[model samples]
Target: MKYLVIGGAGFLGSHLINSLDGEITIVDDLSTVKYFEKKPGINFIRQKIENFETNEKYDYVIDLAARPSPEDYINHPVETALSNSIGTYKALEIARKSDAIFFYTSSSEIYGHAEIIPTPETYWGKVNPNGIRSCYDESKRFSEALIMSYLRQYGLDVRIQRPFNVYGPKLREDGSYGRVISRFIYQALKGEDITIFGDGNQTRAFLYVSDWVEATKKMLGKGLKGTILNIGSDKEMKIIELANTILSMTKSESKIKFLPPREDDPPRRAADISKAKKILNWEPKVNIEEGLKITIEWFKGVLN
Candidate 1:
């Protein structure tokens, strides 16, 4: 099927683009983007989704476009919200018009600090609307609503996956956008101090890129009509424990230091992925350690 990947130039998007077979179109602007290089063979469109006017459409549209980093959003909240809300709406509109399958990438950030350990899709989030990171969390919440509305009103084929802590190759060093996994991996490889934000008790389930993509692609082809399934590993770890695991694995000389946690930092997060597994029949294959080894080598090449 013909596919269009929004924001296909960056890290996660690039990997997703690479994994696709058959004809694919990429919509992105490489302006001020400092991570992955512009890939080959992708039909790259150089325009912001806001100003973007495409005569083309697709059989499937995967919306991976968003300013994902909390730090980036803090500085540019307006653009952050706009990118997510408007960009997702446009993608949904295209899907509705084309009668295409639409997959929307939401986040575990939508779960915020969960009142529960492993957050089920039904668990209402604990996000602060007034918090500094609200730009992303709330914007994605708005995006979810918008996409679901299309699914209800127009019966546009739609599925939403909320990925947790996805990390792999082509990571950007811009600090805000990359996950804790990429940040720690890069710092350890660079012989730099590993900074753990806060006292390090905050937890997240880290899903390797391959595992994430595998789960995602499977769910995108299923009976989950207008459903929100989280695509992530069920493995859980604290910030400090995760840091130590990396240090132990790499045998690096980098010191693990502490910083005060940022606002809206979740106390703990994990996916109660029973839905994705039972429904989609997909589970994460790569364990954390194996995933880290692969990621570390990728960073070594780029940093060297």
Candidate 2:
């Protein structure tokens, strides 16, 4: 299969690229550093997704391009907005022209402060378009809307997967990019205080990268056009509990520090994966403990 993986150099993108075998072309600007080595036989192009130009036909056009780091989008909201808006348009145009199946990695952040627990694909999200996180949230929402428009207006085959708190190796462990799992692991390993932005009661369900990758491949192979699946673990954990777990796992003496909550941070986030189970016969197999153990080992290698 010929695949065009935009943002294939990022954490999740790198893992996905390594899993596939075939003619693959990757386009990334190195805005986020790639932790894995680029494999042989893969074509690499360094460019912004919005400015990317390609005429080659592809069987799959997957757009994983986006500045998902809260610090990143907050710091560079305009670029983040443009990446999903114009960048998504660019991806759609390519898929439409090549008649390739289009896949987009939409985040669970789209369901900002969801009123429902284990939010489903049907939830029309209670998102704030003007909030600090709006750049990433609204842009993803817009990208999904734009994809749907393409599906109806141009008959483009598309799959939109909303992943919740996917964490694993290669996830950046610096600044704002060091999301909860990676950040906690890094801090704990280095004997630094593990910072909790809120009261430590905010909950999140994290899916291991491998489990998410499996679901993604299933979604692609199923070729379900116009399908929106929530690919995430239904298991949940509190922020405080997560910190404690990481500390114990890493055997570090990092104290847990609670700070003022970040504005627009979701209090609770999980996924209702019934749709994924029924449609793709898929559900996350990695429990939090197991996933954390594997992830901690990877962080150790990176640190050492």
Candidate 3:
């Protein structure tokens, strides 16, 4: 099948492209990632998705383009907002015109400091509209609304997936924008102090990228039109525990250091994947330990 993957050079997008086997075209601005080796069956276009104009039709259009990390969003809020809002609109329009199945990769941050623990898709979410994170969070919420509107007005076949903290190979392992797992692994590999932004009490459910790709492929194959599902592992752990796990796995002398928390950082995040289980017959197979081992190996290679 032919596919259009916007932001296909980013962490999750790159993994998705690598996992797919058909004709695929990747449109990206290369904001976060600059260089990707060209491979057969994948066409790479180095352009912003908002400006991407294509009359060619595809069977699937996957929108994964956005500044997803909290630090990254706060730094480039305008770009983040535009990519999710305008870029999303452009992607949805492409899907509508092509009569293709559209898939949007939303975020767990949409459920900001959710009152519900393992947040379900039904939760309306408690988000600060004017907060630092609102750019990323609100944009995602707005994008979902846009998708639903198209589905209602134009009968567009669209699917939305809210992925919780996903980590594995190709995850940005640099600066403040890096994800928790990758950052911890990077510090441990470098024998530097592993920094925890809060009191190390915040919890997050981490899903390996491979498992996320598997579930995404299943959802695409199922053609679950107009469905919103959470794609994440149900296993939850504290930030301190995750740090300790990384230190143990890497056998590093890195100590855990707690710092002041960032603004609007959620205290806990877990996904209620019951909907995905019942609807797509999918569940994350790699546990935290196994996932970490693989990630640690990749980080080691990068560091060396």
Error of 2 at 36 (Å): 3.5
For all candidates, the clash counts are 0, 0, 0
lDDT of 3 by residue, 1-304 (tens): 8899999988888788878878999998888883355677688899999999999999999999988777888999999899989999999999999999999999999999999889999999999999999999999999999999999999999999999999998898788578888889989989889999989989999999899999899889765888899999777799999999999999999998888999999999999999999998899999999999998888788679
Q: Rank the candidates by lDDT, best first.
A: 2, 3, 1
Top model number, TM-score: 2
**TM-score to native of every candidate shown:** 0.95, 0.98, 0.98
- Model 2 TM-score? 0.98
User: Candidate 1 — which residues are off by over 4 angstroms?
Assistant: 35-40
- Report the lDDT tens digits of candidate 1 across residue range 196-272: 88898888888888888787778667566787898887778988888888888878899988887888788888889
Which regions of candidate 2 fall more than 4 Å away from where they truly are? none
**Which of candidates 2 and 3 is the stronger one according to lDDT?**
2
State which candidate, 1 or 3, has the greater lDDT: 3
- Determine which window of 10 residues in candidate 1 has minimal summed lDDT: 30-39
Candidate 1 has a TM-score of 0.95
Candidate 3 weakest lDDT stretch, 10 residues = 33-42
